[model samples]
Target: MASNRPAPQAPFAPDASEPFAYGAPRAEDGVWEEWNPTEESLPAVRGRHRVAKQRGGGLARSSTVLGVGVIAAVGAGGMASANTGKPPVSIALPDLPSVDSLIDGHHHTETPAASLSGVATATATAVGDSTADAGEALRSRIMAQAERQQSKADSRATAAAVAKADQQAAEAAAKAAKEASVKAAAAKEKAEADAEKKAEQARLAALAKQYTLPTSSYTITSTFGQAGSMWSSGYHTGLDFAAPTGTLIKAIHSGTITEAGWAGAYGYRTILTLDDGTELWFCHQSSISVSAGQKVSTGEVIGRVGATGNVTGPHLHLEVHPGGQPTGIDPGAWLRGKGLTP
Candidate 1:
């Protein structure tokens, strides 16, 4: 309602007949003179005065204070932008109160510095929460991968152990089989040997019933092929049975007497020829009970034992010749072939 410009001063009027000059007045200097003021003649004010509305309605603010408020607002906006990685947000300042409102004290306003501080705090809190969540997710993934690796390692170890056990079992089975085979082969060989011995015994029993020895109760004095100076040949060629004089000599098997006579060194002798053309000779006998060309049965009395003709004591000399040959074979072996031990 009041003007800010100052009232114009009344225009100055000079007194009649008084001259005005630009020079210095004389020393008396008692007269007063009026002059008009111009724009150039005004004294310069040092700085600007800006009016601001305060609670009391009228106050003056300096330009320096306004500049500081603006700088603080801008710095706060820049800090928020940098932290959030976005463009700076524009802030709208509240309208200044009208002159009537200020005079009546009816309007209120919030400071710009306080508003910016609240915005920055909220943004920082949101960023921190996001970072914490991401870290938790990464830790979970790492733990899962480690667990999978451990499981695979355990499975591999188990498989190796099973394979080793299987191999050992196979080796043991092979060894047992080899030992069983050796035992079976040995058992088979022993069984075969026993069977062969039993068969040989049976054959000897059958032959014993078909033949008899030449004289009973006699001892063997000499075997076939003995060496002695009393024999006409260099080596004796007969089996000798030593006995008391007149001991009976039997026919070894069923045979026919071919000769019954006294031979030179033999003294008394008898020759019996078998059906198979094998000749049996009884020599050095005390007496001959069989005649030439006589048929004698098995175990029949043929002669008596004597110490006759190139003999040292009483003994029966027996010879064997196949097909009436002059040279004789071993009589002991020939009798054994017929199942006769003597």
Candidate 2:
């Protein structure tokens, strides 16, 4: 039979470096702003694919020529059968040759020409050549695409690693700054607390030296505001210390003597005035050492206890007044308030 068939299709060719520009703003300094797509502005592609088709001129022409050769041989066989009285013989053909070797200058040949078997073999060989060429081209393109994809994946992984390292360095710097600030504030607070504690201790020490007891050997025989038959006003308004004659009397605090002379019914009197106008009077003195307007220190000898004025025995009479007003209070309690023992 005469063979007639169309040529096989070729493989598709893909463009490797096609430029796809997304929608982004153009800047004046040759910089493009990134475009971020929202759900409303995003584009979708459905069932999109790159289709390729191949065409062949050589395979189609060769197949047609081989078919004519086969028809001529078969017609010659039928004419010979009528001329001779011999019986007609049938034959089988082998497989076709590879298309790659044929294209590269390697042609194939079979023996026993001018027979139906040889003609059929040549026709099948032409069709097989076209199909094999198409398949080889497709395989080459697929292998090239796989290599490009692998290279892109490696580049993306390297970029991600560099970005992560930069982020970690920034975080470490921020944490160090925060710790330094906290340490500085704590140091300042500690300095202020130490200074305040030192000031309080100094104030207490100064108060202890400013006050002291008048005399440690004397006893209180009469207190302020005493009510007895010994007074014409029915109440004693001054404190009295009863001791032996010529007992040494000392100044209670630092002050100036404002009056040191004889007074009626009180014998020799010595009046001392403090800085704030409080006056202390010591009476019934056998002798007075401080003169008027003389400054005296604490524990200094001021007078000697005696039995002068309206008294039954030798004793020292003391009186305290604020601004010279006779508002008598317990002298023992007053001395204690100044951190002194009476």
Candidate 3:
């Protein structure tokens, strides 16, 4: 039954719980314009993302909220219930939409349904493959660099060893050469000394072979400086050999006969000139076998002994004059120096 007891009074202003906003009223000239809001003439209040209208335009907002709720449910694998009085509802999930449709800002009547997980999995696999390849390349470069450094180190070591070996070898060779040179010098000096000694011995042996005695056999008579009345000088001035009247008198050494003739108070005198200009005088000879300026060898007969000079008996007088001087050294000592005994 309808009760007509006085219907509830209609409120003059809009409901307070409803979303309401006001637009700035337009002004004509300087005065505030009169506001007249009809059914189709109300101004819309707007922000960057939305416009709020009055009366019939408010229903469009409710429908847009319903559409957004339907999209959210599909993204969450929609759960809704068909049973009345149930707290939760059950609904089938729709596939995810394409990325272009989600960001286009222009609405589309239909969006392609695809598996997002498949695309994500493929992209992740590709990223992993690229990362692994980059890592391997970096590792290869490091290994190559390390190998190069090691090779350089090895080369340096080998070169150092080779240089050391070469230096040692050179030193050894130099040492060997020095020793050989020293030995050669020593050998040369010793050989020279031996040759000099042998030459000296050979010279001495030849010199000994060239000397001879004045006479083969004879006896000393009156010696030199013996005091007596021998005519001219009161003392004997020469050595005397007491021999037979015809005893052979040979040359004592090789020389040239300088004077071989009769001299005053002497029968036949012979003066032999030696190599050093010393004179050997043979006086009181019975006969002379050599002439002046004649060469005579050692042991060659040059005269015969006789009592021709001032002598006490038949003997040969002999005098030695050095450098043709009138004085002489002892003949016995001179003959001994020549490796002979008189």
Candidate 4:
């Protein structure tokens, strides 16, 4: 029974390593908890401890500020080195070709076939685009040239048409002028011809007023101044104008009335005595227009012829005397001297 009894009284002494005993109660909390932690177990609960409220909060904030300061310092150092134009800090070529080893190797004589192939492809593309651009430029130039040529041709045609029209107009005007001149000349000639014809008609009328004849168609049947026993004066002294009965008779000269009556030997007689005392006897008249003492003038129809006297046929016995003598001279020569043929 004595061996089985629990012993009591271990003195209360603090251990350096172990701050709290496993079964002892803490003085401040009355709970059994470990105060000191081990190195291996420290990582698990390094941030779990607490102090005073203000001190712990300041300590946590100071740790966060230190971490930010460290990161800013490293960024500032890198920027300063870059601005100073320094080389890279580390060189780790992952994909770049090692030109150094190739230069140290054997002299490799070969064509740059791969590089040439790339250059050729690029040059061919450039040449193809250049050709297409040149072709477009040439076509544009050709179209412009053609337009210019067409414009020139149209101008020439217009000029030619204008010239031709001018020539035609000139020709028409000249023709009209020539025709007018010809018409003027023809009108002047016709006027001259008409003047000449009128002058000739005036001359013929003046001549008709001067000469006279008794009958239109007559013959000299007997003559005056013949020594024969044929007249009452024992000689032929009158000119006989033998014509058909009823033939027209005219006065030989302008005179006044003497006798217009029938005589025995001179049938149907008309005697006209002129102002100069020359007596003209007209016989063998069919009628008489004047009385025995009626006055007469030139061209007066005094009598007409008839066979009422001692005549064998129808005739006009005419006699001209100087002073109304019974016998007359040759009247043919006398009338011919006064611009009359009969």
Best by lDDT: 1
The alpha-carbon lDDT assigned to residue 61 of candidate 2 equals 48
- lDDT per residue, candidate 3, 1-342, as tens digits? 897798788534455453332234325345554556675795554667554333332334433554466555433331222112122223333554433344432343342223233333344344445555666798899999999999999999999999999999999999999999999999998999999877866764566567666665689876777898764678777777778888999898899999999887866799999998888888888899999899999889998988885556777887888899987656665665566666
The regions of model 3 sitting more than 4 angstroms off are 1-208
Q: How far out, in Å, is residue 141 in model 4?
A: 99
Q: Please, what are the lDDT tens digits per residue for candidate 1 over residues 129-152?
A: 454455567778888888888888
Sort by lDDT, top down from the best: 1, 3, 2, 4
Which candidate has the highest TM-score of all? 1
Tens digits of per-residue lDDT for model 2 on 190-220?
7777776666556534644775554446788
Q: Give per-model TM-scores.
A: 0.52, 0.39, 0.39, 0.37
Residue 294 error for model 1, in Å? 2.7
Report lDDT (Cα) of residue 258, candidate 1: 94
Worst 10 residues of 1 by lDDT: 55-64
Q: Enumerate residue pairs that collide in model 1.
A: none
Model 1 CA lDDT for position 135: 55
Model 1, total clashes: 0
Cα deviation at 127, candidate 1, in Å, is: 11
Give the C-alpha lDDT of model 4: 0.65
